[model samples]
Target chain A: MSQKMTRRRLLLGGAATAAVAMVKSSFGKMVQTGIPEAAMDPTRQVGPLPGVLGTRSPFEHPQRKASLTSSQTPLQDLYGIITPSDLHFERHHAGVPAIDPNTYELTIHGMVDRPTVFSLADLKRFPAVSRICFIECSGNFRKPDKETITPQDICGLTSQSEWTGVMLSTIFREVGVDPKATWFLAEGSDAAVMTRSIPVSKGWDDAMIVYAQNGEAIRPQQGYPARLLLPGWEGNTSIKWLRRIELSDGPFMTREETSKYTEPIKDGKIRQFSFTMDARSIITYPAYPVQLQKGWVEIRGIAWSGRGKITGVEISTNAGKSWQAARLQEPVMDKAHTCFRYLWQWDGDTTEIMSRAIDETGYIQPSLKELITARGIGTGYHLNPVTAWLIKRGGEVVYRPEKWK
Target chain B: MPYWACVAGIAMISCERRVNTAPTHFGYGRPATKQEIAAKAIAIRPDGKGLPAGSGTVQHGAVIYAGKCASCHGVTGTEGPFNVLVAPDTADAVPFDRAPQRIKAIGNYWPYATTVFDYVRRAMPFNAPGSLSDNEVYSLTAYLLYANKLIDSSTVMNAKTLPGVIMPARKYYVTDNRNGGDGPYE
Candidate 1:
């Protein structure tokens, strides 16, 4: 379906060129092709136009996957780490509620010296900060054999963006946080009225109250007016459509933290508040359903860690026995996706290839066996084990799934 | 000429004002009410502030456990092929890498006791969710606590008693103090 759409766009561009040629011949010397006639000219075409109401690209059209809960980005077609503003992955508990900007207000109360409510305009008046980071769902891992699955299916839940917003510390200062306040409750304005208890230290450390993503006002799906941004934490912690913040002495233990996000560990002990994502790597190119020729194969993939920067990534051609370091792309930012590549000569022998990430904290990517041994085999969330792809003699590549049991 | 120029400038200003008008207010619904807020604020804190008022004895919980929970969690809570919910308090002495031993129940790894009632009432029994009455949930909490030796077999568990039980693993769990300035850990 995507290939068909790309072909149609190319055909439209050709047709537009032919139409321009026809118009040029009809007008002859009286009408210039570069400049519009004075009678029909709207902006005079001499300087920048004053203003425009609506916009649509003459060449391209990109859309989101709409469903009951979440809409996904087109991951298979993206090139870089930063997802386009319109293509950011979206997950809302209730439907996207329409908010009137003038009436939108954020209240900060409870365990604060000065409880205050700030309007949307008031938030923008503060000094702004920008940072690039990736937000990923806790349940993003999926199996490979399903050919119907696009890159969206494998890991579309994760997307990177340059977010512009006010630092949460700035708001905390305005409200004057009480000394006893240890946790904060961030609530959204949606019908579900989603809420989560965030540690107060995170606000002082690196949290942001963002109103923009990828250089534009944030899209409605990515939290239009304003949202919380917790760099390197789980996506849900960055609450969307934010409305209220209440500081407290302890965690609120919301339904999300207790019944949902928490995963049972080995034995009967359930692990809660496990927010930071461990180091992980995945091969994007020459993956399932993409056939390769027996020649120089440029292995391309992405590596990231919520803890910090990705120190190194190693590729294994013969399962887990041997490994070779892959080249990292330039300007590898912290808490952001770093692209990696390896030039390999493929003789097309049946072999399995895999990639593993090592973060700055010296935490090595664990194998499936190691993961299962540590966390037990009951729960299925936050599975970031090294992924492998099997290449047949015929040059067809397939995903090699590791059995859970 | 000066008066004429002033009149022309005023006309231009009026023309610009006709093109745009700033809105004074936005039409949105009223703020959420206190009752609406209370209905959804069903979270059990570590200090047990939101715990419901009900009590259950271990003897009553044993009967309920044998009928409903015993199939999946085991009869005595130690015979689980699924998840073992109970463990001997002395089992913490065993090393993690040693030979396979009894399952590490809530007594060994959980940092807070309030989490047990909070989790079970929300998503337990594998099939039915939120089916257990408040008394039944309290009973189940009592049974699990008594089985793990955190409480006596004859003890009754309610809102007041459940939060007071100290978990053995509370001391081991530590806050993640990682920051980007000094790497991920201290």
Candidate 2:
């Protein structure tokens, strides 16, 4: 790798010097005339050396936009499946806490036979497991009003990572979880001490206590020492900076579960503990900022479902009047984001394009109108609607804003 | 000692194969003490479980609110610079679809009274969270409830009295029924 980089650097240096010399000679006679010996490529040229760390090119400046409470991932700038650890979206109640892994401890008490506290090292000693999955904030939707919105602006709160940890079922078996314990409380160590009540069935199924993201230690914004990973569930329920897990016979009814994260549904009823995210998809390319061309354009996007693997993604070229299947990228895993693409030839005409996802459970993504009609206008959280992009005759792309109260 | 003998000894000590229905304890972590568990187990349930022994009056809470919470939640808890903790008088009568114009205050939205206490004690005072005493938390909870008209000024809130304060919106909270499908939403 070092040798290849050295050769490439040498070639780049030669090309750069030649280009500069060409520019210097093009208008040298008209302007300041004499090309000095030192002015024409007489400079220091050093060979590239191997480094312990790597960095993105200086030209690539993708960054996560942040507010006071939350930071959004640059979803439109990502490719393939895994989101870079630094670019992961963060939504915390208080702020990220700096914790020392050597002193980190997680307590599991309540309805267990033997209440134990596991240190960071002790957790790593257990059977190790790795899985690629996406964690999306339950409130990950934006009601766009104009064409200036990109896919990242529409939904930048979901990110996928190769999480590494032991299965929660393994720890449950070791602690001898009482069968009568219906729910458990997972709490964080931040200033807010964020807590959420989770059903025990999820723990027995596929819940994990992850300590690493991608291929390295988890980022501080993503929980640093440790966090609870509930696959296919809302991001808030997967408590970050995890420190305690207390099993109980019922939901603890914490403030987060009661006051926040709950959604208002039909018939004047508020819905609580709505965990699994529904099937959703968004077209990343040709989405707001990117203009469309008249000729062949490959429409690309990502689709994911909390229920299971994304089975299919259908694209509609002329709004929702007609639909066709988009090709799904290979190796679609369960509870993970799957990339999809479609080949299209856009004529010089104004049209609307959109994509809808169908998960393994045969559930199709709903439109914003359908969702509002069912849940009512005052609804705020857990909104997953089909996003549409409007392409004008002049190759301008814009978001099709839906009327949301 | 020969190197092969050391390798054989290491292998014999490392690999111990056993098949059992129950997972054997890896004996990794230490046993958590009763006191340690009590310190971190701060969650309060809807049934009044885990409430510390403390009491506070709405009058005491008013003072604390003006000093600590008013800057973020407004003077009367309705006119918020941040989040509105109290809604207008007619907020409850409004239908669910149109209530988005009004804030989801304790009177109009929160289902449980215990949640107020838990939220105030766990995360309040926006600037300095978890800095209030148990009595102070109870007082603030009482003040917010009183300001929202769920409770009276003379009411002294404690673990025993808090669970009995039936929030009007408690009956409106239902478990999620939206099983994903292609048909009409549940």
Q: What are the TM values for chain B, all candidates?
A: 0.74, 0.85
In candidate 1, residue A258 scores what lDDT? 53
Tell me the tens digit of each residue's lDDT in model 1 across A1-405. Answer: 644433222112221322111122453543213322234332222322222332332234555565556777766566768888767888877567788878887777778766667778878877789999988877666643453454566676788999999889888877778978999988787655667889999999899999998888888878879999998888888998888888889987665665456665554455667778777788877687788899899888888888889989999888778999999997688888888889998987988888988889787777777777776664555767787878889988877766764
Best by lDDT: 2
- Residue-level lDDT of model 2, residues B102-150, one tens digit each, is 5687887888899899888988876788899999999999999999988
Give i-RMS (Å) per prediction. Answer: 8.0, 1.4
Q: Residue B93 error for model 1, in Å? A: 23
* Per-residue error (Å), model 1, residue A403: 0.4
Chain A only TM-scores, each candidate in turn: 0.85, 0.90
DockQ (Cα-based) per candidate?
A: 0.05, 0.57
Error of 1 at A277 (Å): 1.0
DockQ of structure 2: 0.57
TM-score of each: 0.65, 0.90
Where does model 2 exceed 4 Å of error?
Answer: A1-44, B1-22
